[model samples]
Target chain A: MSDKLISLLSGIIFGIGLVISGMTNPEKVLSFLSISHSWSAEYKWDYSLIFVMGGAIITAAPFFYFLKNKEVSSLGLKISLPAKQDIDKKLVIGASLFGVGWGLVGFCPGPAISAIAVFDPIVLVFLVSMAVGVLVKQNIIK
Target chain B: MTDFTPYSALVGGIIIGLSVVFYFFTTGRLAGISGIFENAITNSVNRFSNLFFLLGLVVGPLLYYNVIAPKVSIAFNITDSYTLIILGGLLVGFGTRLGGGCTSGHGICGIGRLSTSSIIATVIFVTTGMLTVTILQQFGIYL
Candidate 1:
């Protein structure tokens, strides 16, 4: 129960951050991606997401470094770091596909959930489709 | 509307960082949203925890919406029809799992930890995303 509650709170913070940072808005994300164009208008180059992401990494990195030294977490949960260290085809292909999708819609999983916070037919469609996609991938791999 | 709110963005990010840090310290796991979502659906991870975490994501906005009902806005419509949205969703779904993480996983937690694979993955995704947008613009076409 404690674990569930903590993760729930964590999700809350994350969602709040996403919304406040404008990442949940497809338009803002679209502008950020538009930066790929050299002639994009100055206002169209939205780097606010960068500030949000950078702030997050800056604040979290030191604690993560501290966590690296310990076996159990500060709260006594077992350390669950990923064991996989390989860079293989799946990683590249999957990431590449994700990038394309994101450029197309600016709705990667995290912000897609953030998009849902506002309620839209399109966001729901994306969620259901993405879920189905994950299921498809799982079945194929196994 | 096109203006960027740097202060709010930065502060909100710090709050998010704090939450993720707490998540790691308490759960001993990185807060990779997509990974958790995938694991929950597949029954590959602690389904209850992941479910509740995702549930919290919904509840958080609901709570905030009580105070501020922000109108949803879109700057660029990627496509005129639902086809693009559907296609984007399919690719995201397959690619995130295939790639092993998403923005939150590889972009935030993975890069923070200095994981070589995460960094490489991030670079690839960002590059592809840039190329996708650039190419579409060049061709005056969008999918």
Candidate 2:
């Protein structure tokens, strides 16, 4: 099949998995990260978060295997991976900010967008600001 | 919604992993969150790849909620909504551009592929996450 067809199929499957797994629920995510959550209190120690992560790992196994044999792209061009390997100022500062936002809101951009499907206003604001931020960083500043 | 299943998490993770692999298979892309966003904005990489990758990110949850399960509750303090909207937006966007990717780019796709930049990036992401949580706690902010 064409690349677009494959991506659409992949996206549908992924969306179904997210809904089935309850990763869309920020409460579940927060409780999983914390030892003490009223939600977790009722729910048996659900480390399914790890499983979701693990599932992703398992799914990518084939890719790794392929990489082992074919480290370079098929087109005979060098893989354009990032070259800089330093823990520079940019990484430190940005990660700090991301972590703060993630901790406080229990919503990252991925899940935040999903929350929009649930009609959550908070997520809408997040989406708007995030889009604006992207614009500012790419366009206005540049 | 108290439909509890431990196996689902495993399945979910597997699905994510598979998606990453699929991403690479079709697009020759690494499935890095930051890279996807960058492509979306810059219009340099394949627009189709960016659209589909982002679509997966969004649809992943919708399918889970509507089809697989019935109810999902998320407890968020509306009082902090404004703060979250502004600061979180600026930080993540700035971080992604500056660091060249997000957690997925560094933590999952980057580390998995054994990229040095991803390794350093992951460390910074984790360390900053810890520090941010600590600072928030110190200020008597509970979320």
- Candidate 2 per-residue lDDT over residues B60-112, each given as its tens digit: 66665565555754323332558855787667766666666765566667667
DockQ scores of the candidates:
0.66, 0.42
Model 1 lDDT on a 0 to 1 scale: 0.79
Residues A1-51, model 1: lDDT tens digits:
488888889888888777777777666666667665347564446667778
Please state the CAPRI-style docking class of candidate 1: medium
How much does each candidate deviate at the interface, measured as C-alpha RMSD after superposition? 2.2, 3.9
**Quick one: best TM-score, which candidate?**
1
| Per-residue alpha-carbon lDDT of candidate 2 for residues A1-142, written as tens digits (9 for 90 to 100) | 6656666566666555555566666555544444333244654544555566556655675576667455455434344555655776766666666665555555555566556667767777776777676666677544
Candidate 2: give its CA RMSD in angstroms. 4.3
Provide a comma-separated list of chain B TM-scores, one per candidate.
0.83, 0.81
Using DockQ as the measure, the top candidate is: 1
What's the chain B TM-score of candidate 2? Answer: 0.81
* Candidate 1 residue runs with Cα over 4 Å from true position: A36-38, A41-43, B68-80, B139-143
RMSD per model, one decimal:
2.6, 4.3
Best by lDDT: 1
